[model samples]
Target: MTLRIATAGKGGVGKTTFTAMMTRALVEKGARPALVVDADPNANLNYYLGVKYDATVSDLRESLKRDQPPSGMSKPDFTALKISEILSENDGYDLLAMGRPEGPGCYCFVNEVLRAAMTRLASKYAVLLVDNEAGLEHLSRRTTDDVDNLFIVSDSSIVALRAAARIKLLSASLELKVKNISLVLNRIKSDAEREAAISSARDIVGKDTQIAAVIPEIAEIGGMLSSGSNVFLLKDFPREILEPLVSPHET
Candidate 1:
């Protein structure tokens, strides 16, 4: 069975960073080559994973919009072919970026197609780590279904905390069948502050959604990212971050 995990929060809160780290941790646990889906239109997960790709699902979708496929092929067949071709490979994971940078008109049709393709592709892996856009728009749109665990990442700020609350509330309102929704407080200065961060996160998002993890501020990580370094290979990322995510029972 494939485990579906998603990360969300307002921009700049390190959702993408955590997504990449957690994926590496899973691979370390023997779940090699997990499927990493970059569902955000901003599309920087590829950079964090240290892979380069020229095509996105949106790029393929736009081409379909401009020109019809050969008469023998159906739309679904074409979409599937493009999805298979665009997966950027790495040693322990593969990436599928959802769409290119924003363009004119609605991408509803393409999103629907990509969603279906992602669902189909996910079963081939032991885990699926999805890095979503800031809000719950993708969840609301049902781009991902039966989300096993949803991790809402936030910085130590009121705005980011409130955004996490709204995501929990919106997921409830949308009736998403998510088994667990946990808060992740990132970029703390010290381990001693974890309790305070957890308390604050609980105050904002409520007690039901526990603060699953607290990631300390590692300057090494900042330097790595600034230099366009591949974070998946970084040695300084605290292994404790995986404690809460991989073994939620302990948290």
Candidate 2:
């Protein structure tokens, strides 16, 4: 079964960073056939995964809007052809960028097709990790909910914790849903500081929200994110967080 892990938090909470690293960690631990869905319109997960994106779902949406048909072809056939051309993959995992956002009331036929294809694509993977947007609009609109472990990451601020709480509540209300929601306190300094965020998050999220792990507030770790590379590959960080995620049998 595919383990669907998702990250949710306001922008700059390091959701993208966590998503990339967790994927890398799983891969490094001999987890193959993983998939990472860069669902945010910001589209920065590629940087973390070291992926150079060549196309996006928006490009396909544009093609569908054009609806260009060959001399004798029908519109339906033309649409099918465009859908077949959009999917792409790199070495470690298949990456899909949702691209920049659309207006409030944009047409969505092509988007629906892409969502359907993405669903089928996800089914073929061993693990699927989604880097969510600040408000989790994709999870609501695209029916991409039901994560086995949904991580709500945040920085030092209590405001972020509040936002995570709100997101957890919003996700629960959605008919499309996350099965298990958790939190990862990011950019934590001393053990005491981490303990504070954990305690605050736990208080807000209550018993259902698991504290998955804490990402240290290390200067070099921040530097790695600056260049858009994953720090989870570092021996020490993975040992602290990712290794514990593996089941005993899987080890």
Question: Which tens-of-lDDT digit does each residue in 184-251 have in candidate 1?
Answer: 89999876677777777878889876777788887777777578787666879677668457643442
Q: What is the C-alpha RMSD of each candidate to the true structure, in Å?
A: 2.6, 3.7
Clashes of 1: 0
| lDDT, residue 194, candidate 1 | 72
In model 2, what lDDT does residue 212 have? 73
Question: For candidate 1, which ten residues in a row score worst on lDDT?
Answer: 242-251
lDDT of 2 at 210: 77
Judged by whole-model lDDT over C-alpha atoms, candidate 2 comes out at 0.69
Model 2 misplacement above 4 A: 65-88, 107-114, 225-236, 246-251
Q: How many residue pairs clash in each candidate?
A: 0, 1
lDDT of each: 0.79, 0.69
Candidate 2 per-residue C-alpha lDDT over 1-251 given as tens digits, one digit per residue, 9 for 90 to 100: 77777778888888887787777777777666677777776688887777676777767666667666988997756765564455456665777776765666552653464455446556777787778778756556754565667778888687888888887777777755566666788888898998787778778767566787888875655667566555554544645576565332431
How many backbone clashes are present in model 2?
1
